[model samples]
Target: MRSPTLARRERHDLCDLALVLGEDAPTLCGEWTAKELVAHLLVREHSPLGALGIAVETFARLTDRAMARLGRRDFAVLVEQLREPGLTPYALWPVEVLGNTLEYLVHHEDLRRAQTDWQPRENTPADDDAIWTAIRIGGRALVRPAGVPVRIRRADTGKEVTLRGGAEPVTIIGSPTEVTLFLFGRRQLHDVTFEGPTEKVAALRRAALGF
Candidate 1:
């Protein structure tokens, strides 16, 4: 089984931070407090149909209702539930690795980058590789909808991957971890830069990126 070590680490760390900052602490998830964010995670894993609603627009109301119902539980209990991979299909090793590594990492940052005093967190080489792999796997799907070609570059190794194909692609430059966060929709909070045609760059920037 591929190691889901990064997913596990981020899960633990995110839960700890959620508790330390208390339920009302703000997060980068568009006005979701730490409490609401924790509830969302809980619903995503525990409720299969609810998780489906997350990506399928038609089922969004269902997801919203599930989150609202779970959000009423004690915040600490919600966090504890998320501290583990849980009993759902998400707990399967391969699924956990491919699906959750970036999910937890990005959500972790949603809590972190929202703080008044925040800085880019450091990552290990293994974690970097995992995040880069995850980007290669899921990043394209997130960016392709923008209709502009997109490429992402790792600032450290300079490794590049085409997220979308076109005449000219917007190249996003950052560490893999930051790039992962950027592509996942945390725009202003990440330390990444863009390069490409000015008009194309502006359009992509103005477009809501990430899933």
Candidate 2:
């Protein structure tokens, strides 16, 4: 819920942390190195431009070409280029601004999940509200519940948002960053704490699977 400027600063904080964490850390996403996650972010940052259809087509073609040519040794250089100033314009509309931010914020949380040494600036109530709404929008592409309600509560502030009216509610309680990582599918359910019906929660978890 930080200001756009503050949010960008937060992103930089994570960038520095990733550099320190090294590419070989055990990330929540399979065995991906922190560097690889940043590479994926770079790809997403440059892929969105013009209309959704055009943007998608262009991104696919560009990514294929880039992946073929860039290779692992050159990935960091490419990522540095894409993360340069004013690169946000290349992202698709809506996604360019909001989705990109959401993407980074969630992954940054994922990269920092287990470490107690790092702490993201706490999100204010207003910031939390904005992120809550933004995630609900982006999460649609990610989560499709089969009529099961899921409620998320933030640790920084005692704020709760509920997606209801399905089978039963599967509530997850944790810090906002942890919740974000879980919802983004970077972290496993084993890393999360859940309450309510186990079967229903499992079904909802299956529906909420992340990439």
Local distance difference test, per candidate? Answer: 0.86, 0.58
How does candidate 2 score on lDDT? 0.58
Which residue window of length 10 is worst by lDDT in model 2?
46-55
State the lDDT of candidate 2 residue by residue for 105-197, as single tens digits: 776676776454545446766666656666655554445543567777665565666755445677777755556666776543233577889
The C-alpha stretches of model 2 lying farther than 4 A from their native spots are: 1-3, 23-26, 48-65, 72-76, 85-87, 90-97, 114-127, 145-147, 155-158, 188-193, 206-208
Distance (Å) between predicted and true CA of 174, model 2?
3.3
Predicted structure 1: lDDT: 0.86
- Show model 1 residue runs off by greater than 4 Å: 1-4
What is the total number of backbone clashes in candidate 2?
Answer: 6
Reference-based lDDT, residue 154, model 2: 60
